[model samples]
Target: MQGITGYELSSRKAEYLKYIHMQGDVVKTTEIAANFSVAPSTATKTLAEIAKAGYIEHTPYHGVRLTPTGTAYARFLVRRHRIVALVLSHYGLEPDEACKEAKKIEPCVSKSLTDRICASLGHPMMSVCGEIEHDCCCCCPSGDHET
Candidate 1:
């Protein structure tokens, strides 16, 4: 598809993007491998695949960096996850527990579904994980965020 990341993206892929983006610098193969508990080779292979999809730049044995497309997708995924966690917390799940549940739930959340949820939640400004902000187009037609 021709959306943010240019494909029918996976949340697992989204997770990788978010992790890399959060690092605020090039993320080494070793770091990603350790964080995800996978062998370095496995992490390399995964990174290569995403790179092929054009959301990141990966250099073998070196590190990975997000493309602009990757950044937009990561932001969207984070927003979706925070919203899911927030809603679950309202059902009595502890913040941490809700975050955990949200991880499992994030992969299946579609854009329209996310829009509905974010609206229902009254566009909450913070979540257990920290500040929550949606991709401007997700709901904010004006593309404005409070700074």
Candidate 2:
């Protein structure tokens, strides 16, 4: 209930956070459930747990949104996931396949590793899927820097 702290995030919570970052803004439990092929109740329960952890906002029946802290964490995960996808694609995997592989690998990667991978990828700006890359450059780099 304290949310995920110091490596306590379950795979499901990580997935949910990634989904929220991918979707942007607020998302409904049903939408989240459908994305994961889980029951709405399951999504609701997960959301409630995350909310208790201070990583999300739940407004009874309106929907769910990430709090600032949650958004920062979710963005961190998304950036890492997309960078992994970009690096994997460079290694010759098809775009879609690379994305799937990145999703599978993202959680296991540390922030430091993700930062190094992003740098190694030349600070890619977008994933092969057309989604924006979630890296430090995207957040803080000047336009003069090469992607």
Can you write out model 1's per-residue Cα lDDT over 1-147, one digit (the tens) per residue?
A: 125332246766778888998897799999999999999999888899989988799987679998887777777777778888988898999998999999997778776777677776667788878788764445766654444
Please tell me which predicted candidate would have the highest TM-score against the true structure.
1
Candidate 2 stretches with Cα past 4 Å from truth are: 1-8, 131-144
Error of 2 at 27 (Å): 1.5
Query: Count of backbone clashes for each model?
Result: 0, 3
Worst 10 residues of 1 by lDDT: 1-10
- When summed lDDT is taken over every stretch of 10 residues in candidate 2, the lowest stretch is 136-145
Can you give the lDDT of residue 100 in candidate 1? Answer: 96
Among these predictions, the greatest lDDT belongs to 1
